[model samples]
Target: MSLKTALRVIAWLLLAGLIFVTLSPIDLRPVSPAPVQLERAAALALIGFVFALAYPRHIWLVALVVLGSTVLLELLQLLSPSRHGRLIDVAVKLTGGGIGIAAGWLLWRWRPQR
Candidate 1:
């Protein structure tokens, strides 16, 4: 597979993992709830870099995917049996995604064009 194809696969896997973490039941007893959740949101945002790199020609799609997935995951959280969804978490996810997009754009700008 080409490098771009590999990156795309990695991006999809990360997205799937994000979905699983958001929707499935997991033990949350060991970590501080707020920080752990925040970290996940931030990491999700950073993961956007993979999409941005894998699809530089589709930056808007990358942004849409990041933001849309974040919203979707937040909505899914409402169905969690042991957890409640919060607006702040949604905001944090958005913030992280937006920052990640900006970071990706900057990186793309600096990368030597093919």
Candidate 2:
């Protein structure tokens, strides 16, 4: 498969996993007992990184997609008996996403220009 196709597949899979983890009632063991906000931020950062790699030419669009999905998922959490949405979490997610986008952009810029 082509590189673009592979990236797209990875991005989608990451997104699916993100959604499942975020909404699931079961608590998966985290690497550490970090605060929930940190966990959310870290997860989002990875999501943003994958998304940026998947659509490197449209960085702003990727940001919008990431932010939008974050908002949508947070809202959906209200329906989950085990979860509730929080504005702070959204803010942290955005911050983490920004970091991811910046990292991805730097990597993209350093790549050999064909």
Candidate 3:
């Protein structure tokens, strides 16, 4: 019901989506007009942004979790014969997460304090 709770729920949902899309078969993946790299980056960025909003005081931890999750998920792809993990993809995802964190921090900072 509170803003913090809402943000946390959103972040969790986004993470769930990332896990699903990353681990699911290619045929089960969501369709998007954007390129695969862009989609991956944007998804992680959104998750990072929501996480930043949810825990503004733990930005470092947020970055760690986001980046770590990205790497771990990509690596997990190796378990699926249809999926291949790539370093370049992880690079894009990390960059996007950093950008999202910065943006979210800025927005949170500018919000009117209670």
Candidate 4:
């Protein structure tokens, strides 16, 4: 597949993961261990970073997409009887998304043009 196609596929997958991490009620409960959560957050951020790098021309769009998803999920949590939103959770998601975007920018900044 072409680079653009691959990037788009990755972008969609990242978004899907973001949705899963935030919206899915089944596994949304806080895990017993904090380390696992942090590790998962880090991975999510790394994925965001890679996608941001692949689509740097739309950085703000990417940020909005990432942040927007977080907000949307939080809203959903508020609506759900079993779930409520937490500031710390939002902060964690934002941190992960920001890290991913920054990491992608740094990694791709010096690469030669195609």
Candidate 5:
């Protein structure tokens, strides 16, 4: 498969993992070295980076997906007895996503010209 296609697949996989992690019971989640908000930010940032690479021409769409997913996942968390949605987490996620998007743009720009 072309590199772009492979990257897209990887990006989707990452997204699926993110969803699973986001909705999982708090007690069942793996221990992290950082606070929950920081962890969430880091995960979303990585997600945004992969997605941006997968859709370089659609940066806005990538942004929407990252931010939208952040909100969607947090909302879904409301249904989990062990998880509660928080607006602060969403803000952190957005900040991380923006950072990732910027990184992706830089990567795309740095690619060798055909």
Candidate 6:
């Protein structure tokens, strides 16, 4: 598969995984060696980075979608008995995703045009 296609697949998979983990029972959530907040940030950041790379020409749209997704995912936690959404969590996720998006945008800018 082309790079863009591969990235798109990865991005979507990440999003699906996020949905599963966010909405599933607390016991079903994955454990990470990193701090909880860091793990959350890294996951969203990776999602944002892959998305930005996959659709470099639509970075702005991708940013909006990913950022929105971050908040929406957090908010969805409210529906789960074991999960609760918080503004601080959303803020952290947005920060991470923004950082990743900016990094991806810079990399795309630095690449030599074909």
Clashes of each: 0, 0, 0, 1, 0, 0
Candidate 5 ranges beyond 4 A from true positions:
none
- Candidate 5 per-residue lDDT, tens place, 1-114, comes to 998999899889988998888899887777777997788778888989988899999999988888898899989999999998888888898899899888997899899999
The window of 10 residues in a row where model 3 has the poorest summed lDDT is 39-48
Error of 3 at 33 (Å): 1.2
Can you write out model 2's per-residue Cα lDDT over 1-114, one digit (the tens) per residue? 988789879878877888888788846524568887788788788888878888999999988888788899889989988888888888998898788877776787788987
**Model 1, residue 16: displacement in angstroms?**
0.3
User: What TM-score does each of the candidates earn?
Assistant: 0.84, 0.85, 0.94, 0.78, 0.91, 0.95
Please give the ranking of all candidate structures by TM-score, highest first, separated by commas: 6, 3, 5, 2, 1, 4
What C-alpha lDDT, on a 0 to 100 scale, does residue 24 get in candidate 2? 85
Worst 10 residues of 5 by lDDT: 28-37
Candidate that beats the other on lDDT, 1 or 3, i.e. the better one? 3
Error of 6 at 39 (Å): 0.4
What's the lDDT for residue 62 in model 4?
A: 78
- In model 1, the clashing pairs are none
Model 3 TM-score is 0.94
lDDT of 1 by residue, 32-96 (tens): 55686578667767778788888878899999998898888888778888766788888888888
Worst lDDT window (10 residues) for model 4?
A: 25-34
TM-score of 1: 0.84
Q: Candidate 5: which pairs clash?
A: none
Given candidate 6, what's the lDDT at residue 15? Answer: 86
